[model samples]
Target chain A: MPTINVTLYGDIAQYGSGKQLATLDLDLPQDANIGLLLERIRLPSEERGYLFVNSVLHDVPGLNASHNDPLKDGDHVGIFSISHMWPYQYRQGIHLSDTLKAALEEKGVMKNTYRE
Target chain B: MARKILRIKMDDLSYKYEEVPSKWAKWGGRGLTSNIVAEEVDPTCHPLGPNNKLVIAPGWVSGTPAAPSSGRTSFGGKSPLTGGIKESNSGGTSSQKIAKLGLAAIILEGMPKDSKWYVLVITKDGVKFEEANDLLGKGMYEVDEILWKKYPNKPAIIGIGMVGEKKLSNAGISVNDPENKPGRYAGRGGLGAVMGARGVKAIVVDDTGGPGVEIANMDLFKTGRKKLTDAITSHDLTKPGGGLNSYGTNVLMNIINEAGGLPTRNFSAGYFEGASKISGEMIAETVEKRGGGMTGHGCHTGCIIKCSNIYPDEDGNDLVSPVEYETAMSLGSNCGIDDLDYIAKMTYQCDDLGLDTIEAGNTIAVYMDSGALEFGDKEGALSLFDEIRQMTPLGRILGQGVKATAEAFGVFRVPTIKGQSMPAYEPRAIKGIGVTYATTPMGADHTAGYTIAPEIAGVGGKVDPLSDEGKSELSLTFQAATAFIDSTGYCLFIAFPILDIPEGWAGMAESVAGVTGQSITGDDVISIGKEILKVERDFNTRAGFTAADDRPPEFMRYEKLPPHNEVWTVSDKALDEVFAWVNS
Candidate 1:
């Protein structure tokens, strides 16, 4: 079985809720697609957490779920909550300006591309 | 030459207005409030008892149309949340209005016996106590709208929210800025709760239709104001070109997050992964794209640096920035809330309900940690805020502040010191503020000793934000210097630029005296600040709180923060050194 740590956004980091992050060690065969991991994690049901691997955000099938992307051993699976700028509708706080948004989206911020 | 001391002794409603004997006015602001509070208030008394008095005063350079000078207001009161002295300040329309009315300070003493309310309206004529029961059970906006409608023009109002009305320990006093938004708060400890216990709802000071303030020389005042405004306009921080003036403080959400000091999720993590989504840049874009653009408005009159915003809905409905750092961290990161709108709603509710955003955010986080509520449940958080308004038995305990909430639920992982909820910065992460939280007369206050200017921004040197080297001394210097700036009634943001430039802040005393005609100097500023510190310390000492009670929570020492894997291991010996310095 492959094991990895997962984290949810601070406001709702625990399990059993929408927008939650969790890491489940997968025992599925190497040939399994990304959809299998999405079925495995409960985050989508709660709409609380986003799924990511390493740094790049991915769908429920989990990272390497794409046919073009393949999971390797010791791969890190990461889950992140939506940023305060999520939904792109309520960014009235600091760092939510349009220029910041363009910069973030350009850097694939919501897609988990920016680290710092 | 003007009145300096605004004294309210004991529980009596009778108050005295006296001058600070010329010497103290030179050291106005935090220097003044701390001195007065320490002299008049028993530091050891019950924070909510009859002994504690809430003191509100404008800066030394107030009343003049001198750029950012008229915006700042200094507030000091015994903290119901921290169980020690508390001082919180804000930039809003109220301070200028108050100064214009020819009052130096407004003190609220004595708790009213009734469940009724009284509103203090200080006009040019005199102070009028208007019965405020009709404005009862109202949020800040409702009160603002009513008062704005009734008074029409130049009605600068400060009021408490529902949280204070119920006497919750984490309540904060709310004031409307130039934007007429009740989001600007004198928030930190539960000062509003204290006002609630005393049955005071609102304080409105309007100089219009009243006598205007007296200036030493109108020509000199105009020239002084123009010079000051020009200076502000030229400086990038306060200038029109600055993002702060254009976007207000909402711009810091991403910057602080990027800096890695933004507290996320009750101090369990350092760099919230969802930070990019909530950056200030994103907020401004959404405001425009969603057809709701309200940012960068004035908090006071004749202020060029308008760092206050009025966030509106698609239909132009307002939601306040009760959405500052404390609110962002407390409601957004601590509670697992990734969405900014949800955070803003909770923030607005806190302002309306008379609750401290930080405390309320921390309270919800505690509940999430204890299994009482699920994380990321926006509705649940909203419900908790609503429940607090009903004042249920459980709600009352929650309303008592984060410490009480954690105590009631038997949760030991709470992040509080001296019963006050820690502000936006993680102590283990920042470290120096932790020392201030423990030592400053005001319990667990971050601003009392914020080293961020020198440490992170290099107002002095490029001090490392993360390292522990000389943090104690750094915090000490920050506290003392900040007190001096605070007393001058100079806005702290101005202090930011001053601290940044070489020897910029050093000339602050002369600049203040130059404006106020008080003839103060640098050496005098230092002594006055020290005097203020001594008074605050003596107040705490008389209140029976010894050095033993000044430590941070034990968990901070044992529990290692992730990313850094560091605990608060700064020895008590080191902390004791600060107390000795205070005595020395």
Candidate 2:
């Protein structure tokens, strides 16, 4: 078995302690699927809303983790609990391009951005 | 009232009859009017011009014995708010009573000469226009009082206040309730300005204790009414009269604030620390404690959910009209005044003077940010409305719109989309609402495509509020469904439960079928809504407004709201998809 370090950003941090960052260590068989991670910690979000590492709505059924696609190390993850938080989780890719990031950094808003 | 429209051209005050379209029979009430306006009215024309037609419709289940279904009506036009299309519905005896008079949509055209005020009276007897000046420049409440004394024994009245009298951009049309009070307003969109420009001061419809609506199949209507009313009474949103009925819209202050997207002090921040003091709970307590009125007032007859109320000052004086979540957030939070009483006074001033809450709120936000008025300053804010009434330079720019205000003050982040002002929700946060504000043809309206039903009320499949993927599709679906529901003239609040039961819309439509001597279905309902969208779309295209006007402010994508620290990440390219219905 190999242990993988998983980091949570955006709403997932708020779910645990309202922080902007969190990390969890999970032990699984080699090349485990991404679904196994959410199954390990079923978010107790009473809001009945969720976000995936890839910023999807996490609409998968059941907690079974082996069915999903495999994940690699250093991949960014996010979880959202509020029903309206869906737009924010998926936007890290749209405006966070390298050039855009540089521009945002120059503008000073790129600081405190969620990162691993 | 079935299969009819009281098509009145104001040019010579002449009238004609038009048979109700088959698609419209299922989508009764405001829903019908909105559809007609969208299809026929040119969006780019002057909202007060003859090119703009008003569609006044009763609900599919309206003009019946269904509790809370009898007293509603919707007014549709190309809005002065967002410079798009609008169908603002209100509750009063007018819709129910007018439908009883067998008039469907009241299409008014040709601007009347100045110094003239006309009243359109619809009764079982006939439709006639009577010059109305005894009611000119009167407050809404006062207008209702005079009309009530003139026509007793159940007559409905709709009027324009002083704001409309001036044809200000932030005017609203008012209607009287069962109590003969002009508390009900065709509130948003500055349609009242359109009415004011026509020199129409008040409308009186006397049922005269006359026979009510011509019920086609009474048995079917009764059965459907029982079920629909029960559903309304049973739902948590409508139960305990739900949030809207219990505390009116004030319930939203805490809800939006807790979400941390209330847009305090002109979008400077999201949270208002003094929110609880101006909350619905506080209003309820204050009214009950001070021997003042606090309970919600029904906008129309047969409404199980009474989401309207007339809030009074501490001395038991009517300070303003009923203040809601949007008004509170706009004037209270957005303007940074946490005082409920002050908010109530401001609310009363707008209603009595006939101003749109969204515009007033937007004006306050602009003033606070420009240092013309300090944040949380109630006195200064109240004086601003007075200045607008006086037609000051600041008032003129503020009256034109939020965009105008920003330009006059030279502020970058004006928080307006199109030419219209943004409501309570802060863009760059509240992603679902931001999507709604961005794409709705009505322009930055929270009510145009209310995502709160799903986002906050836990209504259907969970659509991620923050995600932009599939959001265009999501907003399109919601706005379409909403357009259908709105055309029906049924209260949009009923949507809380209607979303759960697929049959709910059909059942309501079935009652409409029984009344109209026509048959309709849920599928027909969607088509009608789609057709309505196309109509509004074509109107805009004719008026030279392109797809470019649909996106939110540029700052929305960059500025991250606090607490959430999120900006609107959705791309304009994605936003263009929401309007794909235009091409289709």
> TM-score for all predictions?
0.78, 0.79
User: If you assessed candidate 1 against the hidden native complex, which CAPRI class would it receive?
Assistant: incorrect
Could you give me the TM-score of model 1 versus the true structure?
0.78
Scanning candidate 2 chain B in windows of ten residues, the lowest lDDT window is B451-460
Q: lDDT per residue, candidate 2, B439-545, as tens digits?
A: 77676777666322332222224433233446676666667666766665577676655544444545665665666556555556555566667666666666667
- Give chain A TM for each model in order: 0.41, 0.40
Query: Per-residue lDDT for B1-584 in model 1, tens only?
Result: 45434444323344466766554554455666666677677777676677678888877667765535557788887888876676788877777776666667777777655545888776665666667999988889889888888775758888898778877787888888765778778877888877776668888877775333445445544554455455556554467746466445554454344434566776676557665455454455556666665555666776666666556555656666534555777888777788877887887787778777778888888878788888778788888876787887877887887788888888898777667777766666556667777777776765675322333222334332223455556556666666776776666666544433323343455556555666555446545565677777777777667888778888888887655556777778777777586666
DockQ for each model:
0.03, 0.03
Off by over 4 Å in 1: A1-116, B4-27, B113-115, B209-237, B314-316, B451-467, B502-507, B521-526
Per-residue error for B63 in candidate 1, Å, reads: 1.4
How accurate locally, in lDDT, is each candidate?
A: 0.62, 0.64
Ten-residue region with minimum lDDT total, candidate 1 chain B: B450-459
